[model samples]
Target chain A: MKKILLPVLILALVIQLFVPSYMIWQRYDVLKSGTEVKFDIGLFDPYDAFRGRYVSIRVEDAIATSFVRGRYGILEIDENGFAKISRVESEPPKEGLYLISSEENYFSFPHNRYYMEETLAPEAEKVIGASAEAYITVRIKNGKSVISGMYIGDVPIEEYLTE
Target chain B: MRKEKWLLDEIEKWQTEEIISPESAEILKTRYAPKKKINLLIVLFSIIGTLFVGMGVVLVGAHNLWYKLPIAARTAIGFLPLVASQVLVLYVYLKKRDSIAFCEGAAILNMAGVFSSVAIVGQIFHLPSDFTNYILLCGVLALPSMLILNAIAPLGIYFWTVLNGGLCFDSLWETPLSTALYVVGALFAIYNFRAENGRAVYVAWISVISGFILVWVTSLLEDFDVFISLFAYFALLGSASVLWERAGRSLEISGTAGTLIVMLFATYEGWWLSSIKSDITIAVLTLAFLALAIGILIKKQRVVPAALAAFAALLLRAIWALVGLNSEPFSVVFMIVANVILLAVGVYYIWAGARKVSLLYANVGMITVCTLIIMRFFDSEMSLGIRGVVFILLGIGFLGFNSYLVRMRKKAKEEK
Candidate 1:
């Protein structure tokens, strides 16, 4: 019983570690190789008891009038990395970077929010709103996007807030 | 020991009744007497202490301490409780294998560790997944601990997590993944029933409730016809009752109660009359199924009178639907008859339980009756004051009925 129990315990621990580790590794890979895109967004801060502090953001040109239910919104990115909905498609794009949104009316970007220190979250929210040019940098690969960083004009939000 | 005393008393009674010889009674007493009782207070305190410690760890993890630390420190802090809890569980499994209290406590702590670790990882990394994914991750991570320790606490938490995860998404039945979560929950409930002691009834209830929600969600899908969904739901109830009768008493009751409630809903004219074609199809199918159920019960020679009455009411409503009885007066009469039949079933359960001296059944019956009565009171056009007065009266009546039972039991004891 002892021999069997030890192996099972080790296996459980390994799997538990593997889940979060694998999630992080996947996001890291996307950041490493994915094309970078920037979008101007409206931001607001909210406190979640479970997930701590984060700022919710809405992309400026991500809304669609001709929206279809249960279809992914196809987004076209310009040279400057700003994106607009080209059309809503039932299937994901065959190649290149495109924003895939689950919601029809609004873009449900995976990287819609930036998590931060509980105290600093409100400051980030304020900075995003106060700055004339507030945009978020995201790395998109194979229809998956991860928030790389947030910027107030040319400066990173973290650097701007810290200074 | 209290158990031994009870056994001894039962043996003495049998002896007085000449059901067993004096020597046989002595042998029975000797065989059944308990030996070497463990201190229950120690076990209880140990469980309570572990639970509080586990809750404390979760609270501390949730309290934004991660923000105060550097990235590497935050990651290490997130993993610390998880690794520590795993080690504790392993120690308990190897060293205190026979101690249920210790194993259960350790497993609970392990579950909390799993939840906190996943939550912290998600928060720190800003994982873009929804609550459903987090809940599923926590449930999966805690499954081994639940099975290894034969712990019901972790299993119960897993069940609740799946349930709330479904609610969080507002598409528990609609989403294939959420539906899969419900299936996983049912499987866990079954596993808990088989592995844990004295937990079959609770697990059975959970299983039936989960299945009901699944079927209801399937019914809400756009392409699925309503009549077919209703038929499928009724069939599910019937199959569950017949198949799980041997599993435990609660499964049968859950199925029967679920069927009765659905039939009661079917009787509401507003539910069926609005969609005439679908309504007629459902009414016809319901009648056929109720008839089939009644026939089976009669053939088995186990026909319950209250069940028969409920079925009869449903049958009448079905007939009324066929005849297109849309008059307000006729609908009111139909509703009253159905409700009265349901009330009769509750009363019958109460009377039968009291007569048979089963407190659990009696309480179940009393609750059913009380719930029905309260629902009726609220459904009526009675004033708030009148509703309050009726509720007070019902409470007093319950007390009086309990007092009567106690008096009757005392009389039986004196006679004996």
Candidate 2:
């Protein structure tokens, strides 16, 4: 048992560790060189006892399209510099960034939650709530994406709340 | 005499009664001791300790105070606790290998560390919090380590996590998930059932199987799940009777008792009347399991639980069919019938337990009857003062009966 277990256990642990390491690497790579875009977001607050608290984010599409999961949606910057999907596509665009809808009634951006300190999340939610316009800066490349910063009006939510 | 139950019982009684000093008892017992007797307390503590570690890591990940650092540094440090935990586990695995408690703790902590490793990355890069995928990752990735390290508690936690996942995520794999977990749990039973003295194995197998049942319970098909549970529990009971007679009684007791309790739930109109968008799948699944349960109960000579299942199935069938015919009469009839069945079951339990001198069953029966009266009181149009008086009287009566039964049992034992 010991003879066979050592190698197999080590391999399993390695694979286990590798997944998160690979996620960090892949996400970092996307953030460093990915095409940057901003999207105005609608938000609410929910407390996840397991994962602290965060703003639950939603986005309105600039151009309405069939809400088909697994289809690619092409990105185009709107008049105010926030992103809007130009159209849904069966394949990735030849020379521009796109994000895939993972759920039927999908939010355009890949990431929805911006996890924060338990005490601070409600404050952020209220800040976003009071603001007339809010957006989040996202770095997107290929089909992978990450939320860089959440904004209240024109100011970064973190900086705004601090001020 | 080495493994004789009477000898072991005598030794235990002698130790407990202070007739022999523990060390002296141990010395005497060594000659007659069985090969292995898994310490249930240690195993139970191991499970709890492991849960604390797992929950601690998750809470700490949620606390996440270091996101302002550069992404690279933040990401690098994420694996720090995970690495440290892995190192500790590896050392325990290779060297200290001291006790089951120590090894089980180390292995389960490592499993939690795997969850933290991934979760911290999500925290680091502000990844979307999709717990379904996240926990599924944790359960699947940590599974091999659980078996390889012989950590049964991790298996419990694994099923528990997926059970929550099924509830939280509402996956397509709900039934399949339970099936798969039961396969492992049954394997654990088969492996450990006939051991010299196996409390820890019994506990582990119960956790795994009950975990499977619980996950299956949290779904849309209410009528089906209730009867299916009977079949599953009794089948488990029957198999335990054959494969491990001593442990089988424990399983049989819970299995039948559990199905009876579930039948009480089936008595509620809400369970059958839920407009849960059913199809042919529900009927087929319910019928199949009900038949299997009836067969097992007859074979095992379990008349009471089998009769309970039979009653529940017929009630379920009649309720669904009558509801289809748009009959309000059966709905009204269901209430009277449910209470009648409830009253009958309660009376049977009381009689069976009293006849057999099994105080636990009799008390359960008494409690069941009391609950029905209390429920009726609440449902009745009686004044608050009147209801309150009834409640106090009922409580006093219950206490009186309980003591009277205890005295009677003691007298019976003294006579014997």
Candidate 3:
């Protein structure tokens, strides 16, 4: 154990020597470069002691929400707030275009980047909270994406339109 | 023969307790009979060392020599007291060889030197009076030396490192980096836990708390609101409960405390319910968690009363949430009544539980139920006189009960 520890300690020391103090670099970079997306904001779970809320976001164009709802078809949303999609389509489209809402849920998240319609009421009801909006930035640089940051205002709509 | 055996046992115990050179101890046991020469020498050297250190302090305090001394000179001068003290100790240790006074003196001098190092460095640098910078500078300056020297002084140094690390987390590292540092610290603590005794327990506790603090800080930087914060805390605690279930009962005790602290913080923040409202899915998930935890308690035949209390409190909040407070909906009253019923049921379980576990669960459950009742009473628009009287009576009752329990515990300990 001592022999094994010696080299590891030396390595840690070596790493420390080389590790320049670049504080908050990752936070700054992620905030700067992360992809911005709009989802439906569902609720805010507020804690009294820690003093924060968990904002749930419902992605308007979620394929899995549809699948869970047993809805057959791709979903498309019109500017008139109308949604339609073809179940005849064998697989989800690759373009990743969808009418998204800014709804947020704490745990339940969409599996794929496809559009969703309001076929699942109970699911949507479970997503409701102290608020009605959810939009967050997703870092999509790799094949993976996660909630990088959340937006407080209607920046999701503004960013979607502008970008 | 028995006396000889006892003497040998005592000698062995003393040998372990005395951390200095074993040869010195054996020599002291044999050759170092009490002599005026050794005492005189120890006192003489100690006085000389004290004078040297005093002079060094005076030199530093004189201010005229401050700027004249280069940084290297200043650093060297700052260490003069330590050097002098060590030399004095070494002389006494070699000459008189009193291990008890030598070790104790070494401990004291080492502590003093650590404080002086921090003070002198801060003074010489003309550093601002900010706490974070002071702690960071102190830790950074002392840590490497402490570890390399194998000084027990690292206990304080590592503590300061972790403390300043948490305070400076937002500014010190990206989220990942912060998390990594915390993990590194925790790993160090775990490494210490394999020691021959519980000597590393402090390190373990510090590491766990510091790691969680870093986690919390990182989450805050991500703008996790109070509700999410509670969820995160509870989630982490629940995870820890499952993962560290076998680490030992001592760790479990502390872990339970940690979980309780999180739940208390959740209740205090009002996030326990808001998080649920923010997302029903999360609410349901938390409920499921509570149910699962409760099941664990029941199945294990050892209720984690803290967990039960937290879930019970959550139940009340859920009911309150179901009936909007502003609306004063029927749901609120119904839920509160139902909660009262649940509390009764929980109390019944406490009474029915096996004697071994009942006390533990009952204390925690009753505390939670009492807190809930108190909160409800305080929140309700009752008459001031009645409220005041009730408050006083409840406070007195709690104090009296706790005092009686404490006395009983003390008596039990004395008997043991």
**Fnat, 2 decimals, each candidate:** 0.36, 0.64, 0.00
Scored by Cα lDDT, where does model 3 land? 0.43
As for DockQ, the candidate ahead, 1 or 2, is: 2
> Candidates' lDDT values, in order?
0.67, 0.66, 0.43
Q: Report lDDT (Cα) of residue B56, candidate 1.
A: 78
> In model 3, which runs have C-alpha deviations exceeding 4 angstroms?
A1-163, B1-73, B81-122, B125-134, B144-157, B165-178, B193-201, B208-212, B215-221, B227-251, B254-354, B357-359, B381-416
Query: B1-416 in candidate 2: lDDT tens per residue?
Result: 35566777798899999999999888877767765556868876886877797778778877767656777787777687678767867787788675677777877888778777787788767777677778767777777766665666666667666566555545434457644754564465455555434544465356536644653564243434334444444444433443355565565556545545665655555544544333355455545645665666567665554346344545554456545622455544554566667766677778888889999779877877777776666654335886588579757976997899899999999999
lDDT tens per residue, model 3, A1-163: 5456445534433332222111123323433564434344443222111101122334554443443332123344446323333232333346543322212322123322211111222233344433355444454322223344333354432232224
Error of 1 at B284 (Å): 14
RMSD to native for every prediction? 8.4, 8.3, 20.5
For residue A114, model 3's alpha carbon misses the true position, in angstroms, by 63
Model-by-model DockQ, in order: 0.42, 0.54, 0.01
Q: Which consecutive 10 residues in model 3 chain A have the weakest lDDT in total?
A: A45-54
Best by TM-score: 2
Of the two candidates 1 and 3, the one with more favorable DockQ, higher being better, is: 1
How far does residue B86 in candidate 3 sit from its true spot (Å)?
10
Per-residue lDDT for B303-359 in model 3, tens only? 444344445444555555555552334434544444454455345445544355757
